[model samples]
Target: MLKKQRILTASALIAVSLMFGSCKSDYEKLKASNDVAKKYREAVKYYNKKDYNKALDLFDDLTQRYRGKAEAEDLFYYYAYTNYKLKDYTSAGYHFKNFAENYPSSTRAEECRYMAAYCSYLDSPNYQLDQTNSSKAIEQLQLFINLYPKSERVADASKLIQNLRNKLEEKSYADARLYYDIGDYLSAVMAFNNSLRDYPDTKYAEEMEFMMIKAQYLYARNSLYYKQEDRYNQAISYADQFTEKYPNSKYLREAASYRKISDQGIKQAKVLVAEASVDSKVAKKLAKKDTTTGQPQSVVGKQNERSPQNQ
Candidate 1:
């Protein structure tokens, strides 16, 4: 009885395997066939089933063949989205932009345009990496908004643009902080100023301003004695501006302290300058006196004075 039951189970398993193999063979035959209509239909069926890889393969094959045909529009749309579903964002972005350009009058054009920009946004790297994609995403999103001012997607595009811009701002802030960390105070001050100029409303504004004051102070402190007074004055000016702009800031106390130190530095720098000037004048006087009296007499004068006619 056990042997008989085992034989029955083996027969059932073989039947199921053959059925599955036949289904797979049918798909393989369809893939190799020259039936364009059947291929297109199967591609759509696969797409609906969320088999994006198979759908993309068929769509790619049908793309040029369907060109100028009425089916091309839907075919291209599906093709673009299939790439997107497969997470090929760069290709998706290109195809989506092409779709928007090719079917400007289509109702899907606006959505495709926004999707193109959003894909670029999705492609943007982390804040520490290069921001070319982030910048490109912002531009694309902005263009979408400009092209479709009343689009419901405009709000979403605007938000995406802002997010990209924030990432760029973060990159700029980190670069400036790098200059500071490396003790390149002058470069740090310039970089921090550029960060502020580029992003006037950056969340890092307060911290950047405070850092500018500190950077400037350190730069002034490290300058040559002759240049210190003016540089320190500049630092004091930065500190004053920071304090005036953010009086209630947590960095206010530190900024004020920097200002005080800069003021003292300016005073000391002036004293050093004055002492240097006095020392320079004294050295010049002593040099003139040495030239006039301390130098050896000329050979002719010594010879004349020691002549035997005088003896």
Candidate 2:
């Protein structure tokens, strides 16, 4: 009985040795199979050295190989950052967006979202150029704020939105002012009108109102005699708006003066027409005289006498 028990014990020991040896062999195989952890370390080393291209290649390969593996999140984040540091903004934006969408509940998701928006913001053109990226950055950042209302990054997003909006505003105002400078009164009016619609509460609103008045006034001044009536009315419309909106503005006095001149010119035009219709000879005499010569001669004689109410 003792001998049989020894044989059974030895057999059990051999079975355990084979199982342990197989486990050790498998561990060795995994260790030799291009150690992912070692690759991750090397990639980080390359990134620290600012060899972005090499770092990016390693990070990209690791991210794909370890899609759902232990270090996948860290690897993917560094992958996106590598692209960003390399100034490959489009690819950086794409990877960052992907990171945000795929890892919405991850610890770094909010940061990923913000970085995605910032990537586009970084690619925005100069203030004078097409602002497609600038517009997109605004929309995406607003969306990010909506998504993470209580994020610590909210302040940054708000500031970035303001900066981008200011760019658009600057472009609009510059174009509007250019129109004013070039004497395209109609186009100037349109541009200023659109600018106000876009930025009604801006500090430039006051300046814009002044510009609008000037444009309309000039438009009226340059109109043909036949077109003067309509143009004058348009000038009065803008002048009235300025006076109503900025009652205490320094430009108010000038605006009022313009208003008065337009009113007086229209009245004088009517009086001249009425006089010419009644007596062509006196009208011709008055037409040859200058009204500013400090002369008290009766230019409107019987015409004024005929319309006492108008006197």
Number of the top lDDT candidate = 1
TM-score on alpha carbons, each prediction? 0.81, 0.69
What are the runs in model 1 whose C-alpha is more than 4 Å off?
267-311
- C-alpha local distance difference test of each model: 0.83, 0.77
lDDT of 2 at 186: 77
Per-residue error for 75 in candidate 2, Å, reads 2.9
Candidate 2, residues 173-200: lDDT per residue as tens digits?
Answer: 9999888776677788899999999998
In model 2, which residue pairs have backbone atoms overlapping below 3 Å? none
Q: Give the TM-score of candidate 2.
A: 0.69
RMSD in Å for model 1: 15.1
Q: Report the C-alpha lDDT of model 1 over 1-311, residue by residue, as the tens digit.
A: 99999999999999999999999898888888789899999999999999999999889999988999998999999999999999999999999999999999999999999999999999999999999999999989999999999999888888898888889999999999888887788888899999999999999999999888878877766556567678778878998998888989998877777777677777766766677687987445323321111111211223432221221
Q: Which candidate number would show the highest TM-score if scored against the true structure?
A: 1
Model 1 scores a TM of 0.81
**Where is model 2 poorest over a 10-residue stretch in terms of lDDT?**
291-300
lDDT, candidate 1, at 144: 94
